[model samples]
Target: MEMFGKTLCVTFDDLVGSGVMSKANYKRYVREEKFSFMQRGGNGRKVLIIYDKLPDKIRTEIDTKNPGAKDKIKKQQINPMDHRLKSDSKAVEFYKKYTPKISLDRQTEYVLNVKVLNAMVALEVSMRDAQGKCGFQNNKEIREKVIALCENLRERYRHTLPKARLMEKYAAYKKYGYAVLVNGNSGNQSARKVGPMEGRLLLKLKRSKFPVYTDMQIFEEFNRIVEERNARATREEDKLKPIASPQTVINYLYKTSIKLWWYGVVHGEIAFKNEFMPQFDTKLPDMPNTLWYGDGTKLNLYYKEYDKKQKRMVARTIDVYEVMDACTEVFLGYSFGAENFLTQYDAYRMALETWKVKPYEIVTDNQGGHKKPEAQYFFKRICHLHKTTIRTTASPKPSKALSDASRCR
Candidate 1:
C-alpha cells in the first residue's frame, strides 16, 4: 500500500519499466493526451520540461485514495519533466511554438500561464550551461541528473511551472503560424465563405445561368442541400456537413469584412473591377487653395425638434454644407442644421468666410437649388465682389430640354 501510494504518479518509462504497459500502448497514451514533450538538448546542458496529463484510470485511483490528490498532483508533488520523447522531431517543433495557450483563465480563472512559460525557459537556460564537459547522449546518468535538477527547480518555483493552463488557445497554428498567437482564428482566413465544397456550392448558385437569388433565400437553399447530404450519408464519418447557423453562411459568403468581395457579390464583377480594382497611382497636389469645391451632405444621425402641430419632439436628420480646397483636399469651412437649413445660401456663406484670399475658381454640382435665379444671382454678385470665377459641373449626358433649361434659367 505504501509502495502503491509512492508510485501513484508514474512517468512513461516508470509504467513501461514496471511491466504496467508496453512501449506501443504508452505511445498511444501520449498521443491521446496530446502531451507537450520537448526534446533533450543535443548537448549535456539544456533539458526541456515535458508536461503530460495523467492517465484517467491512474488519476481516478489517486483521487479515490487521497481525496484532494488531484489538486496536490497538479502542484508541488513533482511529476516527471525531462524524460526524452522518442527525440520526436514534430513534437519538438510543436513544443517550441505552442507550449502554453491563452484565455480567460488569465482573467477569470487566474491561471499562471506566464509564470509557467517563464519557468520552463529559465530551467532550460540554467541547464544549458553545465560546469563540466561530462555528458552528451550515450551517458544516461548525467542526462538523468540534468533532468532531476530541472524537476527540482520546477518544484521549488511551483507557481512558475504550473502543470496546466486554463484556456485551450485552440487555433490552427500549422496553417496560420505565429499569427495564431495574436490573431487567433481570424488571421490568414480564407476569402471564400468557408471550405471548398460550401464555397463551390455558393458560387455555383450565385453565378449560375438561371436567375440569381437573394442572400437569405440562397442560404436557405444551402441548408436544404446540407440536410440532403446529411440524410443520404452512408456512415457518420463520411458525412459532408455544413455548420448549423445560416448567419455563418452569410458571414462567409456576403459579410462586409471584405468590402470589395461584398461589392462583387452584389454588383456585377465588371462593376467591382471598374470601381475598386483600379490601382490608384497618383501624384501630389500642385498647390493649396488654388481652386475650391462646395457641396452639402446629409448627416446620418437624427435631431429631435419640437413640432408645433403635434406638440412633441420629432427626429429628423440634418444636412451639412462645406467648402473644400480642391488642390489640397482640405475642408475649409462647414455648417450643419435642420434638413432645409444648409442650402445654396449656406454654401456661399461658408465659402466666403473660410478663404483668407479668395480661391481663383470655385466649383459646385449642378443642383437645381444652386441654379435658382435668386441663388445664381446671389453667387454671381458674391463672385463679382470677391473677383473669383464660379463654375458648375457639366451634365455629362445632357438632354436637349435640360440644356435649354440651364441656359435660360
Candidate 2:
C-alpha cells in the first residue's frame, strides 16, 4: 500500500509481519471496494504494490515526519510471490522438475521479450538503489551488464516470458497483498458458452409435451430447426451454432425441470398420486358386527338356460349380494338366486337377514337401484325403525369390509 510504503515507511514484508494481518486477507480487503492500490513500477514489476487508507490526521503526521517515505522505501523489495517462490530451498528444483514446459508462439515470444526488457530495467534500479545512487547515475556500462542477467531467465523458464498480466492474473494480489488468488476461471471456457439459439432450442425441446423424447432426439430436431430457420438467413453469421452435447442437454433439463422429466418419462398421474401424493389416516370400526356393508356384483360364470321359444339353451347371468362385518373381514351372509336380481328390496332383505345382531351402521354404494330416492328413503326409514344409521357414497371406493376381505383372500 502507498501508506505502508510511502507514509508509514513500512515495507510490505514488515507491514504483514508479526501477524498483524495475513497478506492474503490484505489483498482481499483491497478487492472488496474498501480501498485502492497503484503500481509504482511497471505492472508486472508492481506486483508487491498496495494502497491502504489511513486517517487524515495520521496521514498528515506521517507525511510531515517522512517527507519522501515512498522514495526511501523504494529500496525495499516487497514481492509476496517472489518471497513465496524463494522461501523454500527446493522451490527452484521443484519448479524445474514438475512445472510444465512451454514453447511460445512467435506473437507470444515477441510480447514476452518486451516484458523481459521491463524486468531488466527493474533489476537495474534495484541494483543501483542498493548502492549510493538515485538515478541512472550508476555506471551505464555496469548497469547494462547487470540488467542483462534478468534477460536470459526466459531461456531457463519459458513460462516466465509473459511477464504476468498483473490486472488480469494478479490484480487482487497486488491490491490486497495476497500471494495466492484463485484463478478458477482462467482456462479456456469455450464449452460452457450457451448461445441464445442453443438455449431456445433446448427449452423448446425439453419442456415440450414430448418430454418422453431422448436428448439425442431433441438434439437432432434442434439441428433440423436450425437448418430450416437459417435457410432464410441473410447473413452467414446469422445461422445457428450447434447445441450442447446430449448429456449436457439432459443435465440442463434435469436441473431446470426434474418434475417435468419425471412426469414425462417415468410416471403418469396415477403413479404420481400413488407415490408422492399424501394420504390421511382413517379410523375404522373397532368391533365386529358394529358396522355392516352390502354390495352386489355379477358373477363371472354364466349358465345356459332353456329358451321356450327357440327350444334351445340360452346364456343366463346371475347377480350376487353379500353382507359383511366391517371389522372381521367375515362375510356374514350372501344371497344369489336364479330368479332373484340385485334390486333395492333384495339388498335390504339380504343385509337384514345376514347379520345375527342388528347393525349400528350400514354402508353401501349409491348405485343402480340403491341410488333411487325412494330406495334411499326406504333404507333410512328402515334404519331409523331398527335404531341403525345408513351411509352411502357416490364414489366407487371399496369399504373397509371389502378391503379386509381382499386382504384375507
Candidate 3:
C-alpha cells in the first residue's frame, strides 16, 4: 500500500469541524478503537487511518525517502514513564487512594468531619497568630516565638492528629487562660496629671502675683528656698516670698562688681562710712588771701618731630599752668611752656596786668618753683611796693585743687 504524504495525527473534529465528530457513528468509532482519524481532500475525500503506531510497511516507505525518518518517528513515541505522562498518572493514583471511602461507619465519618472542621479553625488561628506577631512590627523575638509555637504544635501532633486540629485545641485552651503559651505583650500607661503644687504655682503666675524673674534668678531663688526650708524645724504652711541674697541683689542692681565700684567713686558715695565722708559734709573755715587753687596740665601737641639723624620729628610736648579765682572759678591768667617754670613769672605778670581790680590776696601752692628766691622776690617786693597783700595756703587732703580742676574740666 502507498503511504500518505507526511501523515499528521489530528482529531476528527479538527479535520471535519468540531460538531461533526459527535454526529452519527464517529464518536463511537473513536472511543471503541482508541484511534485518531484525519480527513484531507485527497483522491475524493479519503479517510486516513492515523494510529498511535504506524505499520512497519509504511514506516519503511517513509525511511526510504528520508533516511532519518524512521529514527525520528521512533524517538517521538510517547513513553509511559515520561515526566508529563507520569504526573497525570500520579494524580489519578492519588485520587484513587484518597478519595472518600464510602460505606464506612457513620460515627467514624462524623468524627472525620469534625476533625476537618477543627483543622480549618486551627489553620485560621495559626495565620492570625503570625499576623499578630509579624516581624513587620520590628519585634524579632515575638515573631520567632509565634513561628516556633506553630511549628511545635505541628511536630507534637504529627502522628495521629493534623497540625491544624492541634492549633485549634491550643488556641481554645489559651482563651481559657491555660498556661500553654506565655504572652509577651506589653502596654504603656497614661502619664500622671500635674500635682497641686505645680498647679498652684501656675495659677499664681497666671494671676500676675508671682514676680517675673529670669531662669537663673528663679533657679537661685529655688535653691535659697530649699535651703531655708531645710534649716527650719517646722515647715511654714504659708506661701513664702523668695529671699534675695546680698550678692544677688548687688548683682541684679549693678550687673557687675566693677560697675558698682565705679558708681561709688564717681558719685563720692561710700559703701562704708569714712572720717572724710563726714568732713566733706562739714563747713569750711573763712580766711582772706589764705588759699589759692593752682594747677599744671599737659596738652597734646598736634605736630611731628625730627631726630638727630637729620630725620624730621615733630615737637610733641606742650604744658600749661593756670591761676583761678578761688571764689568764682574764673580763669585769672595762664602760661604755656615747653619746659616747666620757664614762663612762671610771665604767668604771674599776666595775672596782675589783666585783673580789672587787684585784690590783696595772692595765694598759690608751696611748690619750690613758686617759692624760689626769684619768685619770692617778685611777689613780695613787687606786691609790697604796690601795697598788694599776699598769702599762701597749705595743701589740703587729697589735693582738693587738683580734684576741683578735674571737676572743672
Candidate 4:
C-alpha cells in the first residue's frame, strides 16, 4: 500500500497484508492472465508488482486504499546531495604539509584545475564556519548550498560535479592539497598507449567474443584492428592510435568487469555455475564419526623407474586413497598404491582401526573400483556391522578438499 521511487511498485506481501488480495488469488490471477512482474532480491525470489502495468480495477483499488502514496513516495525519494561525509584522521596530520609554499611547477593542468575548484569549495566552507564538522547532515547541507553559490567553479571543472564526488575530492584536498589530484600516469608516454578509446574497443571486442581466444590472441587482434584503422586513415588524428603491449591487454582483461565477461568462456559453463550459481548449503553432522568423506587422487610425487621396452628411467606417480572426518576435516586414514579395491580397503581399515569408532554415514564418489564385487561385499559387511549407510555424491573441488599431504606433494 506504499509507493517507492518513480516505478511505483509494491511488494506482494504488502498487498496481502493490506487485505487488497489473497496470496492464492494473486498467484492464480497472474497465471491465468499471464501477467508480467519484476523479480529482485537474493536469488530473484522477491516479486515486485508494478502499479502502472496493473489492470484498471486493481490500480483503482490500490489508489483508493493508499491515499498518501504520492506524499510518501516524495518523502522517500533520494536527494542528489544527501550523502554521508566523514573526515580522515590523517587529514589533520597532513594539513601543515600542504601550505601555500608548496611548489606547483610539476603539477599537470588537469590536477591544477581540480585543486582550484576544490580550494574554492574549501574557502566557501570555511567562510560559512563549517570546518571540522564532517557529519552527513552538516556536510550535505553545506554542499547543497555551496554548489548553488559556486557557479564559476562548476563551469571551470565538470558541470555535473556530483555531490559524493565533490565530498571525496574535498577530503583529498584537505589531506594532500593539489598533489593528490595529480594523475600518476599523466606524463608517462608508455602508459598513454592504451588510451580510453582503445580501452573501450578492447572491452567491446571481448563482449563480441570467441570461445577459445587466449589473452595473447585477443591482444594481437586488438592491435591488428587499431593498426588497420591507422593504415586506412587520411588524417593525422585518425592515425594517432598507438600500438600497446601484450601486458596492457592482460591488465585490462583481468579487470573485474572483463573477468566476468570471460568467466564462462575461458573456464567453461560448469566452472561458472560452480562459482556464481546459488547452491544448497548442506548441514553437517554435530559430532565426529557421525559422517565421513572418502576420496582418491594420484599423488604428485614421482619415482624414477626403468621402462623395459623404452630402456629408460621414467617418472610415475602412485594413487592415494584418503578418508576424512566430515565435521573436523581431519585426515583419518590414507593408503598409497595403484588405485584398486585393495588400496581403498586399506585406507578404510586404517581409519576404522585408528578412530576405534565407525561413522554412521560415508560419502564417496562413484569410482570404478568401488563397484567391484569384492569391494561391494567388504563395504556391505562393514555397514552391517556398524549400522552405516554409504552414499555417493559428486566429487568436491580439488582445491577445497585437498589435504596437507596433497599440498606437500
Top-TM-score candidate index: 2
TM-score of 1: 0.25
Residue ranges of candidate 3 with Cα displaced over 4 Å: 1-292, 309-315, 338-342, 381-409
Candidate 2 pairs with clashing backbones: 1-50, 1-51, 26-176, 27-176, 27-177
- Where does candidate 2 stray beyond 4 Å? 1-212, 226-272, 279-284, 300-302, 306-315, 333-344, 353-362, 365-371, 375-409
Q: Say which prediction, candidate 1 or candidate 3, comes out ahead on lDDT.
A: 1
Q: State, as a TM-score between 0 and 1, how close model 4 is to the true structure.
A: 0.31
In candidate 1, clashing pairs total: 3
Instruction: Return the clash pairs for model 3, or none.
Output: 304-313, 304-314, 305-313, 305-314, 306-312, 306-313
Residue 244 CA displacement from its true place in model 4, Å: 35
Shift of residue 281 alpha carbon in model 3, Å: 7.5
Candidates ranked by lDDT, best first?
4, 2, 1, 3
Off by over 4 Å in 1: 1-284, 299-303, 307-312, 327-331, 335-342, 353-356, 361-363, 366-409
RMSD over all Cα atoms, model 4: 21.7
- Best-to-worst ranking by TM-score: 2, 4, 1, 3
Off by over 4 Å in 4: 1-267, 274-276, 280-284, 300-302, 371-409
Q: Residue by residue across 1-409, what tens digits does model 1's lDDT show?
A: 1111122333444445545557787678666854433433345433222323455664454446556644565554343564221223443343243313324422211223233333344444444443132223223433444345545655654433222431132123233332223322431233223654565565455443456777667667776776787787777754544544344465566544434334555575666666665455635447875566676788787878999999999997877777787677887776775323246567557667756556655666665366556766765665532222233222123234323321111
Worst 10 residues of 2 by lDDT: 80-89
Residue 209 lDDT in candidate 2: 63
- For each candidate, C-alpha RMSD in Å? 24.3, 26.8, 41.7, 21.7
The better-scoring model by lDDT among 3 and 4 is 4
> Residue 406, candidate 3: how far off, in angstroms?
46
Clash counts per candidate, in order, are 3, 5, 6, 0
